[model samples]
Target chain A: MTLLDFARGPAMQFAIFIFVFGIVFRLVGVWAMRHKRDLSEPRQPSAWKGGIHGLIQHAWPYKPFRDKLMTDYVIGYVIHLGLLFVIFFYKPHILFFQDIFGFGWPALPNGVITAISIITIGALVIALVKRLTDPVRRLISNFDDYFTWFVTTLPFVTGLATAGNVWWHYETGLAIHLLSVWLLLIYFPFGKLMHAFWFGVSRYTTGSRFARRGGMA
Target chain B: MSDATTTDIPVDLESKRLTVTRPDIRFDKQGELGDDERVQKAMQHFAKDFGYIAANYMEACVHCGACAQACPFYEANPDPKLTPIWKLEPFKQAYKREAGPLSFFYKTLNLKSKVTIEQLEEWQELLYDTCTMCGRCTLVCPMSIDIATLVGMARHGMFHAGLVPHELYTVTEKAEREGSPLGATPKVFADRVEWMEDEHEVDMPLDADKADVLVLMSSIEIQKYPESMAATGKILNQMGKSWTFHTEGYEATNFGMLSGNTQWQKDMTMKIISTAEKIGAELVILPECGHAYQALRWQGANMLGRPLPFKVQHISEFLAEAVESGAIRVNKVDKSVAFHDPCQVSRRGGATPAPRKILEALGVELREPESTGNLNFCCGGGGGVITIHRADSLRYKIMGNKLEQLDATGAEMMVTSCSNCRQNFDDSGEKLHWDKQMNSLLELVAENLVEDTKS
Candidate 1:
């Protein structure tokens, strides 16, 4: 009865499959590249102490894992927290996912959700701008990096348009968001940003090897 | 004692400086390099090697300059020409001129304009002499291309091309012939051990075959740093622990850290491991040399092709180990002194804490500057960069970075865990007008020695 049903063709299904499969391939590649040399540790008394020290340094003044407080890892915490709220609780997302999986959490109130969404969108934009404009951060970014920036912004632009509730415009934004999410999933496994999944294993391996020694002497 | 009374390599307790007025040094003019025919052939060889590495290893750089930001020397200087990529140009051009895609035109038109004797000398100064090849740049390289490894390979190729530096070759040649860089044989090392035993009535064993500890010191200690070596002998004797100094394996200073010549470094490391294994020592303790600590600590197992069966500890680590194990006792230094972070001890080996721990054990008040540990600034002597005569100016510049921190510490003296760092600090401190005294962990530990009669 509505155009919303028309956009739900099988082409979207293929895109979803590519996204999930791409993530798996990335995990396999990173794991395979790790520690080609079977490394050994020299026994030291303070190895574990060193790992604890390093972890503390990384998370210092910012409880990054569970808190939304801006004091710790200011940029990292702010952007990621804003992103989580937007991706999972935006009204259009809840309705779309509710249809896809037949289950959904209550969406945040429309005004509150959009407010949070705009804040997140702003943070991400600043981050992308920083990467391009900042001399040091720009030098460190790569081809895959720019690709991530472009694709992320596309979802937000479409979602804002779809938010007007202008007769099926919401469905249009939902479709764009889903497609972007899928593309990101697929690209995840191929890039240096793959470090997200890979770094845990790398850190743990480095930690445990040196942990047994109590940290480097 | 006055500077006039100080020996050629002085042990001046008064000025709290090692007053060594070392002869002016150069690394390029030695060997078959001086002969025109050999130099020409060397040039051909240089061109080929430089061409191969640049095309194969360097051609892919995005020039993002991320690596330049990582390099401490580049960060300190901010000069584009001083950057790692630009540093390779002179060498890379040598390759382009000899065997590059357009070498034919170069050959016809004497396209060798890109390669020159003075340019070669300048590259030698910048790449070999000034640049420490610290490898920090490689970590920041998105390509993960290890510029330091490339530089070392370049050094090895340069050696094969007969362009070895006299500064390191002079030491390596001595090490090759005498089993010590001081031109001392096993007899000289043994004699020092004997002298320690007689003076202190402690029977410090020589070639204590199958001892539990293989104590390796540098030529600096054997020849000039005796008060420190005496402290070591004192500690080992007090512990009554199983330890020996291998007369043959006496020198632990690996030139790999200097020249980045991996094979030669491997040869030097293997000698220590074999000496330790032969003596059946469970511990291989490296004395106070920055690059020596790195070669053994970071590169030991790789150089040996397996896990080092014996443990490697820096002298500071060993001293801290002794303090931890209750083998040696020390009195408080009782004066405020700052610690200088050696690039090897702090950054490369991650052994910064051991000295701090030992200094704490001695109750020496440690006055730290803003940046002390792994984020440490270099002491200007690493990567064999100290020996290039042209870098005398740069040496003063970098050392001034340390001297500024030393000034801020407001301390009477500075203690470091490296001989070269101490050497650089002592020489440059006096030259650069920084009033603070510069000394080593060994010298401080020696002066604070408390003979643990209990052990």
Candidate 2:
């Protein structure tokens, strides 16, 4: 078989593995965290509604309700929004769907994906640089933070390289993607990234747990 | 802990040890804080969940120090170590160890990880003993980070560890054993109300099975601050509202707020719910304990495992509702006084029109503090911390910011809706030397009360 053919089959296999194993690894890590016994009485139906209102009190457009969040929340929002768009909307992701899963859809087109990638990359790089330079982040940051930023960016970068499929032939691109996907998965169950899933569940449970009971959250 | 600061961490205790010594209130049966084998396991659980929420949700914090400007303790002590978030680090470090990847390489990084026995000792002061879970810090975070929620979780961890404040645990023990936090037996609890009945024909009824309102008092009010009960008694009689204070479930102030022990909190809640249900109370009126108001008004339903068989209302709310309903009339006193906002009533309710309406109704001339309503300062107490003498130093330091605002008002009386605030205001005044009459709104209102029908 040609290099492209071999790369395609194995690459497809690894992509499916990453999708399945990566999530499992994340779930395992999250499940390991304790389920706080919501001694907070189970909420009532009306109270559950009140709880929704209570949690909403802290939400963005946070100006009148919470002024403390005024400063960098907008910045954080923009950065995250950009990253989300790029990560999920990239041309290669669309290509992966079409080629690997034979799904039909409108892709971001390569140029738009590339532009979005630059913005996301720029945001992250600035954040990392700021963490390194800022006294507060520097003080609070451990090796894990720096390592997390570096490790998290790998899938993005390798995906970029693999997207171009230009340098070091298709073989190099395929290998890098395979290795990065695996490493990311193995790291999932152990890293801070697992917060993605657990934070929401914990927050909703916490809100539900304490919504109408009495005191504060 | 300087020699001059009597309120500083005590010398009476050479070292801290975990003990749940009050045999009267056995909370072991209510130890339902999930799968933790020990308090440490609970501690670990608290840290992981709290830390992850802070990390991912709070990841974007710029640390611009805006929240520092908001914290009264930060402004008063200026210790930098006492900043709300700084106070959170001991718990945060534990979070890092259990849920952080840094745990994978803890020693290599000098993470200072682990909820060590020593660390738990510091948390006793940091989580419960000092910080009040007032929600001011949460309101100030740039990420809208709920530092207060973490405080709640950490407090639960502390409660699990049996590190509840001595006074509150004592109170809870009394409530559990003697049926009142003050160790007031049903007979004594009834006698206090009975004394009011004997004098001036004023009575706050006890266990009126068909009462419309069930009044729940913190045990402190029973023994030390019966004037509040009398004011409530006088007002209910004037308004002719169907109300009774429970002799058996007389205690509403839960130690869980102080200790973070969910079981005790739950049990306390059950007592209130069952009492309210027994009396067929349509409305449950919580006395002026700020946290207690939040506990029953907001949280009691869930802890009861269903909607409370009755509606829970704060005394302020009840009084406010009465005045609004035109059942009672207030002649705003011919006086200008500043209102000290209880953190729970102000922030939790998101409005203060009720008491303000009461003040205006009382004919009391009102002078607004520069910070009033939602922006009003914390009364330097809440979260059951004021009872911890060891936390007094930090507590009073935080009180300075509040005092400054009171002084700004130049109002003769600092009217508040909470007993905890009243107590803390008194505690702070002894040092700050402010002579402002720290009055409970209900007490003050009931004293000047005129019947709306008569008017």
> Tens digit of lDDT per residue, candidate 1, span A1-217?
3333433555467656766675564444323332334233555555555444433333322121123223224555565676677788877678778999999997777787677667767777777776677564564455656786666666665666567554255666666655666566556544444445433333333343334433221
- Give the per-residue lDDT of model 1 (tens digit) for B181-221: 55456788778767766775666667776899988888666
User: Per-residue error at B148 for model 2, in Å?
Assistant: 4.3
Count of clashes, each model: 8, 24
RMSD in angstroms between candidate 1 and the native structure over all alpha carbons: 9.4
Residue B292 miss distance in model 1 (angstroms): 3.1
lDDT of each: 0.62, 0.63
lDDT of 2 by residue, B1-455 (tens): 11122111221111111122332332222233332344465565476355334444333333434455566666566554556665666566665555544445554565555556556655566666556777666555534556766777776666555555555455555455556544456787788788867765676678777788888887667665778888888888787678888775777777655566677778878877888778788887888877787677666765776656766677887787788888887665777888887877666543356788788778776888766676666766677666555666766777776778777877777788877787777767787777665878888887788755551
lDDT by residue for model 2 (A47-142), tens = 565445545553453343345444345545556676566666766666666776777566576777777666767767777786677554555556
Score residue B421 of candidate 2 by CA lDDT: 80
